[model samples]
Target: MYVLGLGGSNHGFSACLLKDGHLESMIADERITRKKYGVGLGMRLAQGFSRNYCLDMEGICLEEVDKIVGNDLLVPTMYFRLQDKIQLINHHLAHAYSAYYPSGMDECAIIVMDGVGSKRKAGEEYEYESMTLYYAKNGKFDVIKKQYGYNLPGTDYVENSLGIFYAMITDIIGFGEHEEGKTMGLAPYGDKEFYEKIRKYIRYDNHANIEFNSSDIQEMLQLKEDVQAIKNQEEKERICQKIAWAGQQILEEIYVDIARYLQEETQCKNLCIAGGVALNSVANYKIHKKGFYDNIFITPASGDDGTAIGAAYYGYYH
Candidate 1:
């Protein structure tokens, strides 16, 4: 059986081909198109297939694949040409499948957390979820819980997001977009008092829900402005490092708490993690050291790039 999986329409357009349950070829559209995240590389995805695998998208040749799966159902048809051949999979489900299927564990608790994903429920018009929990056994997965960014009672915007919070801190420290690792590296040089002050704003309950009000984000924004007022470059650098440290500390706290809560609730010794946040090696180590789970597996491509692999696996398994 030939199954082609596609992930695009948001960021990181990619394609993964699986032949009889084994990976044949996988390529991210960004690598070929030289587009950083492949944001709108939709119909052009076939170009990636043609370049990487010597395949073409012309009529009659496209039927070689028995099935095609894709992530993000709402991709614009104008940009995606394979609408008839593609089956849609939930964004977080793709993340979860990517982590758990390759862990080589028969049963494990899987966690998929990112900046944002498809809505919490289908066709509900609700805010997107930030994380999802699943239990995998016998090659089947079951969702245990889902957590989303806080949406005001009557509004469509989500104001509270740990992922965005971390990204904000990364930007405030002078790193460009997606340069969060630099902020993590600078955390050790900061003071504990700064972390204490920041912790008051970010809150997460035992249910794995993260809540932050406008006050929390507003205070951080003010600090971004305050850092610029310092006359000495050294002083500005010091303050930025402190902010990075405090933000990393908060991120680690929230991650560990969520892991602990999952372990307690699922009682599974094997754990799998994915998403952009899973790329935080410092926090991953902290979770491993906490010893909440005996075995913890994290996919190497934990970010959006791996969603293509997940889409393929979901199609193959189903």
Candidate 2:
């Protein structure tokens, strides 16, 4: 059976074609359109998900596909071509699946942490998910914990998120999207003591979920604006480096804590991690060194693009 998987189109999208449980092709949207993240489409467009390119690469039309799996909303009327053989996967759950299935483990503990996920209604209001923990065994998953934040819809900047906090610090240090690696590079040069400055403004729940107050929001802006006023270039760079160190250190601490909690709860020795935050090599190394699990798997394409793989697996198996 031919299965078409679509992901991203909102934040770095991609398309994948699966033929009888094998990957035929996977193409990133940015590679096709020359536009980063295929922005401004806002989850609607025929060309957004790169379905045409995916179909063409497989030497078949959309009708040839037996099933369609997706974690995003794009071109609904276009779905009529395939009938109702569609599966919509949840945002964070897609991340977890992307990690666990690729890990090649029979059973594992999964964690998904990112800036935002599909918005869900909470009482009278809606919020996006920031972190989710799962236990995967026997081809099934159980959501053990989830952390939702009041992330302002349509924007990446907001409080109450470690992922967003890192993004904010990256932006404050004069970096843009896809340039977070530069900030991570600066981490080793600065002192770990600076992390206390970042940590003071937030608290955590028993699940290691972060809760940032108004001061945390102000801190990034203050660092951004205040640093420019410095007279010496050395002083300015030092401050930026310090902020980068603090952000990276704080992220590593929480990730380790989460790993500890998962190990304690699941007693599963295999670990799989995904979502945008999993892209941090330094933090991943820290988690590895802490030795909470015997085997650790981190999806190389941990962002939204990797969800395509997860969606296809879901379509084929479930």
Highest-lDDT candidate: 2
Predicted model with the maximum TM-score: 2
Candidate 2 structure quality by residue, lDDT tens digits, 1-318: 998887762566777788998878877777777777765454344543477888887889877988898874333533344446777778887778777776789899998988777678879877777788899998799988888777454555655777788887788777887677888998888886667776776677656768874466776668678776788989878888888898888888887898899888999999999988899989999989998899999998798888887787788887
| Model 1: residue 121 alpha-carbon error in angstroms | 7.2
Off by over 4 Å in 1: 39-61, 73-79, 120-125, 150-157, 229-231
Model-by-model lDDT, in order?
Answer: 0.76, 0.78
Q: Distance from true position, residue 158, model 1, in Å?
A: 3.6
RMSD of 1: 3.6
Q: What's model 2's lDDT at 7?
A: 73
